[model samples]
Structure formats: structure tokens, C-alpha cells
Target: MMSVRDRLEEVFERLEKRASDERVYPKVYWAAARAAADAADERRRAGVTLGPLDGALVSVKDLLDVKGEPTLAGSRIFRDRVPAGEDADVVRRLRQAGAVIIGKTNMVEFAFSGIGLNPHFGTPGNAIDPKRIPGGSSSGAGVAVAEGTSDISIGSDTGGSVRIPAAFNGVVGFKPTAHRISLKGAFPLSYSLDSLGPLGRSVADCIAADAVMAGYGALVSTPYPLSGLRVGVPRGRLFSQTEALVADAFEASLRRLSALGARVSDCDLEDLLEQMREATSRASIASVEAAAIHSDWIETRAAEIDPRVQKWIALRLATTAADYIRMMRKRDELTRAMDRRLAPFDVVALPTIPIVAPLMAPLIADEKLYNKTDTLVLRNTTPINQFDLTAISLPIPDVPLPVGLMLVARHDQDRRLFEIALSVESALPH
Candidate 1:
């Protein structure tokens, strides 16, 4: 059997070969991998113990700055942008933990769309079915991890960017508690909601990445058993739009959890939809913050951005000041309500993305289809942002395509959520 380092070298060679053929992203860098291998060898020579992620190949999303690499965020608008002087905070941490930074993966332009269609860089196809999308704006991040080209891939999730692609690619993806990890050097999507996370092949892999990013010494759990944990099932609109396959898979997941001795119960949040509506009614934090970040660029380089992204930004720019204020006020109220509601459960479960991955061709052609699918894709995941809660999307089995079962915990209960996830993941069918 090949060692992890040897396996990574093979993956790098294969990915470099594929890069020439597919043009999945704009560029690939092998220097980072070489550096990581060197460090791992040094540690071995000194007989120093290594972390679980030692020698693991990690991929960074294009939205983030890797030292000496341009932060494209998948747009031609920044084609001539200079390389970053330093690594993004998460990238620095990963390197320090003995993981190799492979290269910057592609994303939706400025991390905008759920469909992952990049007019500038060609979109990465789903690992399960190449004809369909891998989901975005963490598109290539998911592809890199799922294809075994990288052991873990870092992505920024404002809404469903991380989870959507992870679900589409049949991998484990985690969005840590908002603000849990530093965002320095990361290109902003939605400043208030953006979170740096990872996509990996297993829950342990995801946790390993999280430990590094969070600057935790180790992932020491209190060993909470699954038997008595209360898993809340939010009743109503959360599942109203789910397709039959997702519905069945989600139901089966609940049964599996129950069989593992979890106390699964229905949680009634009569105001859930109303609160979500109110929070997003006027100007969402994402829209307003995104508009703010791109205000100057939108004015000077309006024609340079992808038309769809430009239109979305324009809509945000057009919002009245009152709209922003109203949304902020309501967002606070909704956050409080969600906190109160989720207090009793260890984790609230929902589908990561209500619908499966859709083809990029049709969505790129028809704006309406794009909007509809985009909204549905981010619906479940976005609520966590609204409440400022920590959540994780675990992939479910027995589905033709990848689907995620979202586990949401109360505000600031991130560790608890991760612990619950570990237990639930152990009980999930392979």
C-alpha cells in the first residue's frame, strides 16, 4: 500500500495532466506540494509525532489568497491582478499543520452562484456525473477533494457554497460557526455570513481540517454518546419543496439515527418561514455587504464582470438605505427567535440542498431557472447564517446522486454540533 505522501504525489501528477485536458481552473501550482512533502520528511527525520492531517494534500478555493498566487475568485475581471504577498489565514494554518497546499481551485465568479457556472473559467463538473454541475461557488474545491486529487479542500460558505458542492460530490463538508475561523486574505462574498470550511471524504477528515483552521490544539471530544442526544426535526416548509428522492433519503436517515439510540422528535417553529421571510425581505446581509465590497469596482469595471453577477450586484446597489436598516433589525429579531427555538436540541436536521444538482447549460441559458434553483439550493443552509448558528452537512447514502442531511446547532454551540455529528456519522449507512 502507498503512503499518504506517495499517494499525494500521484494525485498531483494526475491533476496536472487533467488540468491540461479539462482547463477546469486557470492554473495549477506544484511548488506548495513539494514544500509540504519536504516539511513532512523533516519531521520524520527528527522522529517528531505528526497530526492526523500530516502530509495531507489540501486545495484552496480561488477566492482565497495563497502566497504568491493571484486571487481570481473565478473572473476575468482580475486577470492581471498581482499575486498575494501571504497565505489566507486558513491556508497558513493548514500549512503549519503539515498539510500541503496543492493549488487554488475555481469558484463561481466572486462566489456568487449556486449553480457553479463560471463564464470566465469553465465550471467543474460533478464528480458523480460529469454532465451535471458540482455546485458552487465552491465548485472546484469539491471536485478536487472528491476526485482524490486532494485529501481536503477549503471553501468559503456564505450560504450553501461549501455544503452544496460537498453534497453534489458525495463528500463531507463543514461550515464552522460563523467567525470561528479567521477570514484574513479571503476574498469576501458576504462579509457578515462568510465562513471558511473544508470538504473531505469523511467526518474525521473534515474535523481534522477544522482543528487546524480553528487553531485548536486537538479535537478533544467529551465522548458524548448518541443514545440520549436529542435530534430536532423542524416541521413544515423546510421539507415542503424537497423532491421525492431527497424526502425518502432524509426519512431513512432519521430512522437510522433513531436506531442508533438518538431521541428524534419533531420541533415546531410556527414562525420559521415568517422569520426567514422577514430576515430576507428587503436586503439580506449578503446582498448589502457584497454590494458594499464591489461598489467601487462595480462603478469602474461594470462591463468586466459576468452579466448575471453584475445584475445581482446592481439589484443590491439599487436597494434604498431604509431597506438595509429594516433587514438588519428583523435579522436580529429572527436570530433571537431561532436561538430560543433551537435551545432544546443538540442539532436540528434538514436537507443540505432541497434539490439535487442541475445541469449548468440550462441554468446559464435561462435566468429564471437559475434564480429558482439558486434560491432552493441555498434555502436550508442560509437559515443557519440568519441565526448565526453552526451547522454541518453530512452526505446520505442510498441516493443515486449525493444529498446532504444538515445538522444545525444553537448559536455558539459549535463543539456540541461537531460531537453530535461524529456520533450520527458513525451510525449512518455506508
Candidate 2:
């Protein structure tokens, strides 16, 4: 194997060639990355390897800490913020596991949008189609993984930040159950909902990154037999209203799984999802919690922030405490009910997004169009977060633009979800 330093230098050269592209990174830590990799190479010579992830190049989202870099979160508001005093908890763990940190990827401003539009740093287009949105808040993370700049990209998924971009970029994105990884030193959009995850080329890559982030060696899921596995398809808007090509691709994936001996059936999760939608509609925890975190900045620096993000956060001033309390109570009840509804199946399947990546030009030009498209983009993936569950979105091949099939599992059943995804991924024809 080539030395880790060699690999990191190659990545650095490639990044420098595309120095003007903000879609991929905030800053390239060429020296630090090379130093880390050199240390790893030394350890390798001494027979002290850090398992499969040793010497790997990885990307961190801008919201994550990295000792001396400012946590921009893709907005101008933080240009003057002090540099971090130390690496975030996840960065600390990745370093210990012998991974070389390449750079910080750009994201939606404060991780509030699903469209990945960063007005301050310029919106990063989709890797598959430069004209389309690359899925939000983890936009640059997805691009870094798709273009092979990083072995894995670590990002946060408050709603669909990780999975949406993964779906758009044709990579595997895993959103572990909240609390599975530490959030210390990471900027929070909604501390109540923010959770960290990884985007990579395959399920195995995500599995390895997740393990390392949790302070361990790579985790392995036992090979599960496809035969007799029960996968549920929820019957409602999640199953309907999908674009022609997207629906066709999702159905074809289901057929392949069924042919592989898995029992695919439709179930009524409308009540569960509906309750979640209603509660969130009344008052979004993301908006209220974001307001709390930005109260000071919103008062003094609203103009410096993205206008759309600013408007959304400002609306929290109108939210009543009673409404927030009611929403939380309802969310708890619906979460329990949804878990029970999905308990009978090994996994629940859905199209990660109702439509493929949309062109950014028209959406950005029209507020109505942007809002409508953003809601559609987030509709399917947000419910999983509301229920505090885990999910993985796997890319579906044979399409012009990428499409993803999401497999959702009960809260804290991340390992089980990975196994199910592995079986499905293997069954699909590449």
C-alpha cells in the first residue's frame, strides 16, 4: 500500500488545481494532513496500524471543529468568529484512528435549508449535474465523496442534511440515531435534533466512518440472508407524487429485492407520518431552537446572514411557548406510535426524495418555487428525524441523474439498518 502521506499529497494537488471551487471545501489542510499521514506511515512501519481506516483521507463539514479554523457553516456571519481551540469530538476520534483530515466542506447556511444554497460562499452544484442542487446542508461533503477527494465525508443530519446530498450525489449516506456520536465542539442548528453521520461510496465506508467517530475500530454487521426478510413500503404521499423516472427507479429496486427472496409489502404509515407533519407544521423545533442559538447574532447581524435563512429564524419570534410545548408532546406520542408500526418489518423502504435534483437557476429566481421544491425535497426524509430513527440512502444505478432508495429502521437500530442495506445493496445489479 502507498504511504498515507503520498495519498494525502495527491489529494492536495487535485484540490489546488480546483482552488476556486467552494463547492468542495472551506480550507485544504495540506500541511496538517500531510503531517498526520506521515505520522501514520511511521506507525505502520512499527506495526501499529489503526485497522482498515488507518491512512485514509477524510473530509469534515464546516460546522465541525478543527483546532484553529473558524467554523463557518457556509455563512459570512462567522468570518470574525475565533478559531476553534481544539478539534471536535468526532475529529479527535478520527485522528486517533489514523485518518488524515483533508479539509472542511461547505454546507447550507447554518444547516437550515434542504437546497444546499449558500449565498455567502456560493451554492455548490450537484456532482452528477452541475446545473442542479446538490442537496443541503451537507452539500460539499457529498461533492467531496462523489469526486473521490475524500475516502469518507463526515457531516451532520438534523433533518436530511446528509442523506439528501447523498441521494443527489449518488453516494451512500447513513444517519445514525441521535446521540450515537458526540456533538461537543460542533455548531448546533437545532441541538434537540442535530446528529452526526457520514457520506461515502458504499455502505462499508459509512460503517467504518461511523465506528471511528464513535471511538472504536471499524464495526462489522453479520451477513444477513435476504430470504424471508420483511421490508415495508409505506402507503401515502411518500409512495405517491414521485416523478416518473424516480418512481420507476424506486419500484425497480423493490422488484429486485423481492426477486432476491425478500418479502416486500405495503403498510399504512400515513397516520404516523401525518401526525409528525402536523406537529412540525404547527411549530418547527429547528426554527425555534435555531433562534435561541442565534438570538444575539440575529439582533445585530441579520443582514450578514442568508436572507432566506434569516427570515426563517426571525419567524420564531411569533411562536408561542404553548405551541412549542404542544408540538413536543405530540412528537413524543407519534414517535412511539410510528416505531410500533414499523416494528413488524426488518426495514421500511421509500424513495429518499420525491423528485430528482432540480435545477438551481429557476428555484433561486422564484421564492414560491424555491419553497415548494425545498418542502418536497425534505418531506420524506424529515419524518425519520422527527421519530428519532436511523436511515441509509443507497444510490440506484441505471439512471441519468442519481436516485436513492432509503431504508429506515427503528431508533437506535443503526447496526440492523446497515445489515439490511448491505443485503439490499448486494441484491441490486450494478
Which structure among the candidates has the greatest lDDT?
2
> Per-residue lDDT for 350 in model 2?
92
Q: Candidate 2 local accuracy as lDDT?
A: 0.88
lDDT (Cα, 0-100) at 104 in candidate 1:
79
Q: Per-residue CA lDDT of candidate 2, range 55-161, in tens?
A: 88899999998898688878888878999999999999998888899888989999998899987777777888889998998999998899888989999998899
Measured on C-alpha atoms, candidate 1 has an lDDT of: 0.82
Worst 10 contiguous positions by lDDT, candidate 2: 215-224
Instruction: Give per-model TM-scores.
Output: 0.95, 0.97
lDDT per residue (tens digit) for residues 1-430 in model 1: 4555677678777876776555354566667578677778777777774687777888889888877767888888776889899988888888788887777788988998777888777878888888888898899988888888878999999987898899888898888878989999999988779999999998788888899899994686654588877989986877878988888899999988888788999998758657678667776678788898888787578778888788888678887778777887777888888888888888889888888887768887899888888888887888777778888888898799888889988877878777888887878888
User: In model 1, what are the clashing residue pairs, if there are any?
Assistant: none
